[model samples]
Target: MQHFPTGQAEHKRHRRLARRNANGIYNWIMTNDVFYRKVLAHLKHDYSKLEQHARELEQANVALEQDNVDLRNALLAKEQQTAELQREIEAQTKASGACTRRWPARRNQVWSDGWNRLTNELAEAEATKYREKSKTRRRKIKALKNRVRTAVATSNSFEQWLLFVEQEKQDVETLLARYKKKLQAQNRIMTEARVLARELRRSAESTIFNSSTTVNSWCSTFERGIAHVIVAGELFSTSPATSDGSSCLRSDSELIYGMSTLEGLETARRGSPFSRSS
Candidate 1:
């Protein structure tokens, strides 16, 4: 309890209060500075993240633009190809129409010529066939004419041959009739001669036994008599031998006279004018 001055105490009390207030304000300022430093660090991290996102967006936009440029180039090339195809189609259509208009007359002319040629060939072939047929028919007709001529000539020759054969047959028949009559006459003469020869032989045999003449003399006389008789008969009759040898037999004188007469007849025949003329 020390007693002091009022002005000093009062001054000391005011200074103490002011110093407490100042210390409280300084603690508040320190708290606020720490909070501001933490906030600044968070803001700095957000700003760096925003800058990286912006760089990625820019790279994606650039790639999209390049893809759009490639698509536009492909579209333009496709449009050019479509236009060229359309032009080619129109040119082909026009060319086909022009060929169709120009070809019909030429085609018809070719067809008509071919048809005419075929008809001419057929006509020529038919004419050839007709000519061949006519030639064959003419040959057949000529051969038939030749056969007819040959047949007619052969028939004429056959008729002539038949006439000749008939003439020969008639001549043969006449000759056969004459030969038959002659044969009958000769047969009768032969029969009479045989009978006469048998009688004469018997008579000569008896005469030979009784007569005084020799056998040789008798044979000579008999031969002379027979010769005279044959000569006389030939001069007088158609036959050389007498029909009856016995009847024709004569005496020696008579035989000699007959022989002389035959000689005279032969001489007269030679001297006759009719014999010389024949």
Candidate 2:
């Protein structure tokens, strides 16, 4: 019975020790739980800060992207403008080259025309000088012929005088015939020369007139082209024949008839003078 009592006391002491150990474990667990909760709260705060920083970084990236896009667009616009300017410059250069080619051709034509005109003028002046000199020579020859005639008329005895007069008459007749023949030849030559000169002058005048008309036509055509380009339409409606009817060319028959009548009048006057002299 005393041994059983000691065993019971040992069991009671074991129960008290287990109860104290359980209480200590409960206190340590509660303290650990508080520390864990504090660690969780700190982790949550750090996560929120990281999220805010990420959002700010995203906004900054978006802004940078927008700026980059704007810069790219500006660069593209500048490139397009430069390309357009280059095209315009190329077109202008081509037009200028064409004008340069035409200028030399026009200048050469003008120079050639000027040279021809100057040559013609020089020839005409030389011909006029020759004509004036020929007229002076003819007047001098006429004076010499007149002096010879007067000397023949003045020479003095009856048979000697008669022989002298007959010889003088023969000499005068021969001289007069020679003078008349020479004068007729000279007149024929002068008339032929005058006709040739008139023909040459008329030819030169016709050439000049035609050249001037061609230049005027070219100018008018050029002006019309410019006007058409600027105003796009609205040129003259009338035909050229109708517009210039007053300046129309006459028939060749009409011209011939007029010339023939003039010739008949001239012939009549010339024959009247010859008849009166006879």
What would the per-residue lDDT of candidate 1 be over residues 1-278, giving only the tens digit for each residue? 22335534654555565567786555545544554455556556766776777787787778777777877787787778778877887787787787677679768888999999999999999999999999999999999999999999999999998887777677566556644654564455444444444544544465546543433444454454455457446433432223223232333543454555445335433433334447
The prediction achieving the highest lDDT against the true structure is: 1
lDDT for model 1, please.
0.59
Please report, as a residue range, the 10-residue window in candidate 1 with the lowest summed lDDT. Answer: 239-248
Candidate 1 is scored at a TM of 0.34
Model 1 misplaced stretches (Cα beyond 4 Å): 1-84, 124-278
Return the TM-score for each candidate structure.
0.34, 0.25
Which runs in model 2 stand beyond 4 Å of their true positions? 1-35, 92-278
In Å, residue 116's CA in model 2 sits off its true spot by 16
Which 10 successive residues of model 2 have the least lDDT summed? Answer: 232-241
